[model samples]
Target: MPASDPVTSRPPLPAAIIAGTVALIESAGPLEDQSELVRAHGAQATRSAQFMERAWLLGERLGLPDDLSRWRSTIHLVVAALAVLVALSALGMSRAVVGESRSINAIAALVTLLGLHFLTLGLWLLSVLWPGAMSGLSLGRLALWLGARMPGERSPHALTVVRATNRLLQERRLLPWAFGLISHTIWALAFVLILAVLAFGFSFHSYQLSWETTILSSEFFQRFVQIAGWLPSLIGFPVPDPVAVQHAGAQGLTALTGADVQRDWAWWLMGCVFTYGLLPRVGFALLSYLRWSAGVANMGQPDSGDPYVRGIFARLEALDPPLVTDEERRSTHPAHTLPPRGPGIPGTLAVIGFELPPELPWPLQSLPVGIEGTTVLELRLAGAAAERQNAIQALGQIRPWTLLLVCHGASSPDRGTARFLRETSHRVEKSRILLVEAEESNRLSNSASGLRRWSDWLKAEKLDAIELVAFPEVGQENA
Candidate 1:
């Protein structure tokens, strides 16, 4: 089969990327290696969107499927089922304790089922005010885990899928937003179902709902009921009068009666659930979804200053070299000009020695007989740790001009040379890998192999060109 176009070639679809990421996780590979690929590819984009698209393409090429609708549908079904189960449990518990009673305690029921929802809302609010307080809630991880374990033939790959999904989420930085959206949505669904159950129960069975307190007077209870039921009353739900309130709170079996006021109490309870419990949960769920959507959008493009984006741009420039224009600029200080070269002197070019061979005379005190006019700006060592640092610092101070980096033509190109070239390339106008011609035929290897090594290294470093420089005669010393 033909390979897909590279990710950098065209824009990728968001859904494709989302599905692709899941596919990437499910692909056969160690999670570490898979994650490393993501880190490398993901770092190429400045925006989350761009990163996601490219990552999706990479993932697809790595065997991730292009379609993820099945997984998405399955997860939604599972989440809904989970919400329903929670609602059923709460309904069963609420009924076990309160259904048998002639009258239900409205305060107790509200606090039991919906109190946690309110607490979570408070915490969410706090997270906004003081960032990182609730950072541990990784909803994306939960969703990915749930998706991985969703029942089917796919269940066999659950653990690996989970690991891959996690690594992808971490690479994309989408955990918190995903977590909030999923969890809040689940809570919203649960609360809605719980209220539905309450509504169904009330429609079929008659239960007296009231607040009774032995320590509190009928007046206090009446005022509280009136206040609490005020909002519900606006939408045509019945609110009990002072007389009914007193009757309901009279605190003995004698005070309880099967009256029409029971209808009022039930409506008021449902109204409270709508106003206090369901509405707030829905609102929170919606808000979280909005934030998650915004986060998804942000994944496409990131701030310009992000280091990962910059690094990718650097690599991209190497792959498709951009036209470099020396734009006009005004500076207070005079620009540095190259020293003039006579016929005997080489042209005005900087010669940087990279692991200069000991046999070759140091600094080429004069340009080789044939190569005149080039000045030896510096002699830098490339291999050893200490020398590498010194070379980098020395190179940093050199003027921006044509740089001819002198390398041992016999020795093959290595990482040290690559690193030196990569680091110095940024500061210079132009750079060329100059392989030094051997003094004797005893050179460790032929120039062909050395050139081939440099070619491969330059390609890896995304460098465009290489050059060769021959050694002068035996006694051509600087004089």
Candidate 2:
């Protein structure tokens, strides 16, 4: 997509850039310009309209960020997990005296781990952790040392600050949800592995109560009680215990029944793996379902449910109708992700690195079109660590007269976000660099946030003589 240029646009001039700075403030609503306190505004902006004043006050009281749009999904995910935890605890009614406390502790430990992950996100956002540390956890400690030892370049950290931060493949902004999902999945899988090892490690599982009764007078044979406690958390089986379950093996109350030890153990393995394995993912699925429902309910109405949600729900239902064997169960890519959708932006251009579904509107589909002497290229910098690095290297190679970097369409403020444009700006010294900070990516990635930072970096690098211009919506029009 090409357009006629209004001027001899090799690279915009500093005077023109400085003149259009106000448009940044206008497009962004209000610019607090708090580099010191860079926080990603989350769901705060999406509070129910009826409670706007009180909600704003509460957000301020809690010192939370102003954009609460994500609160619905985040809260729904947590609440969904809590609901499952509650249900499982209620069903795993322990006859043992200390059973309740022990189970509660187990749940608490899991919850505490999740909470720590959340705190990690907040701390990273607050810049308490050294730069680029949290998201690039895959880097481990050595990366931290490298980042720290590397001298800080124009980024606020004292040159010494580089001594502590790490070299993340991508920026911290990319790491949060991606690594979060990875960590959570790893933990869930680890839990399943632990349960499998424990269950199989035991030798004589046929041990029954020998026709005895518990303090609650529950006549649960060992088999029944074991299944009872394990079933809900494992597969949502409403029945309490596995005692009544039969297949083939040892006999008598204390001895194995018709259930063969190996065969029964295999079932236990599959069941445990399925329950612990699938629950977190399923819970996330449910959380999305709930959030969508909540969104629809709040936003007037929906003609019907999303087919994606219904498909997942259908998959869940299929589990019981037709027995899926172990091999099929263990296979990866068990379910499909929802179709692509992007955040909203108006009167702005957006181009995702990847093929962002052809359904997107015009300017958004093909952006950076009007630059006079430069070709706008989009890079889908996804995948392994090496891939991201390669994308950056390729970016450095472009040698354009202007380079525009935008992602996700989220015009939100974030940390060290300016570094992207700063580095790109330097690479294309002959070209001007504009960081696209639209509503979707409007937060910290704001071009305005980096403008001063870039100027400062330029001065620090003794490159203050370079001409840089910012093209706001108005500026773009005038140009």
Candidate 3:
């Protein structure tokens, strides 16, 4: 967008953007984990999320709502309907340009993206301001959208997942004083990983659009605009291009929205893996980070759970863990503690914080070998319990390690590591160790400073060797 564009003064987004943002929220982690809360709240939260998603579809596919259907009816409904129509019409103009224009040059692309964004923005406002007029939006709609390719039985845990996540956010579980920002940060970094792939395909690679250009390619770029298309892309933050001005367009959007855009195999590959899980992780991270940086502290107290605390908790419990509830706890069972932490610790930490693991069939050892360290333990655990046990065994009788970094979950990308740190830290304050989690696949740090980026509170508290673990992938084991 030009400096003087009419939208310059508009907030950070347009009409479609709002809807895109809301769509992104549907399966997002910090919120998806709210499924736990849904369980606690029965299906209210789950239903609510479902409702939003479905209502979005309804708006997109169906039309306006009832009271309006009746009163052409209630004043709010009537106005909302008209506002949506006008906004959607404006938004449609740009999309129509893309859909109609024979030219696929940069200018056209820009106009197209802007148009779609406005449409989405209008719908988004309608949903937020006149939600009652759009009550049909929901997860059930998503199920329908997935259509034939839909996964198996829906986990009834959606709502509980919400509750659990809310619990973590409320508790401010990850970040600052924690380890294994791995899972939590995944949501944010996953897109980065996807971007790296696209970049590798086009931007940084010797080539321009092959393997590296996928994320920023034509298909991906337009999707970045369309509400129906933008969710995963936005969640990923997968840059369209590297340069902002010059040829890359508003920031890097130019390169992304540039001419001859095409959706190739690489784009689809990244989209599938990243969208299903990684992108949602990124969304949650943003939500948590938002709360953590500003929202959490504003609560005027240290004890209140940050918005992400509940999310993290839900993620951990999703592991089907061998958890001992307060009721199940006995005085005799010894609690597991972490390795001690201190100022001079040698281990360094890093995050290859990107989207999905390298494409399938990429051997573990042959996969990207990020920054180096004295000890490199590649954890390819299938589930959280396996990872927890591995954590214990890895640090159990080990030496004066300088760093501890974990690989992303070996299977699908749904597992979250941030939740693990939060739950564990609450009950154990031994040896004193800090935890930080991230997505992506690179990071090379010595063991010493790893604790530093982790947290002073944790270090000062003298916690034990922290175990940063991730939950299991709930979808197809083979998918």
lDDT of 1 at 408: 74
In model 3, what lDDT does residue 314 have? Answer: 49
Q: What is the lDDT of residue 440 in candidate 1?
A: 49
For model 1, residues 1-479, the per-residue Cα lDDT tens digits are 11233333344334334434544453544222222233333344333333344455444433344234445566678677766776677667557435756557765675676677677767766655554566566344455567766666553234543454455444565555466666676666666776777787778776765565668777887787788788878877787788877766664223556556676777777787677777776776677778666655544343357554454445433432234455464444433221221121224456777786667655644443344344536665646767765654554464435566777776767656666665555445566655565474322234566767767666644454544444443544343
Best-performing candidate as measured by TM-score: 1
Could you tell me every candidate's TM-score relative to the true structure? 0.50, 0.25, 0.19
lDDT of prediction 2: 0.34
Instruction: Give the number of the best model, judged by lDDT.
Output: 1
In model 2, state the lDDT of residue 19: 14
Error of 3 at 234 (Å): 68
The per-model lDDT (C-alpha) reads 0.56, 0.34, 0.34
Query: Which scores greater on lDDT, model 1 or model 2?
Result: 1
Tens-digit lDDT track for model 3 on 1-479?
A: 01221122222212122223333344453232222332222221232232333223322221222111222123234334444554455344433433333323443433333344345335433543454443355222222233312333332332232333233332443222111122245223433543454335433322122222423664454443333335546655333332322233223332455343334222433453355445544554465456455533332121215333344334433432245657656456444333332332245322222232443221223212232344333343344565655544454334223323343333222334433333223222222221212342222222344434344323322222453332222242236
Candidate 1 residue 22 C-alpha distance from true site, Å: 14
Order by TM-score, highest first: 1, 2, 3
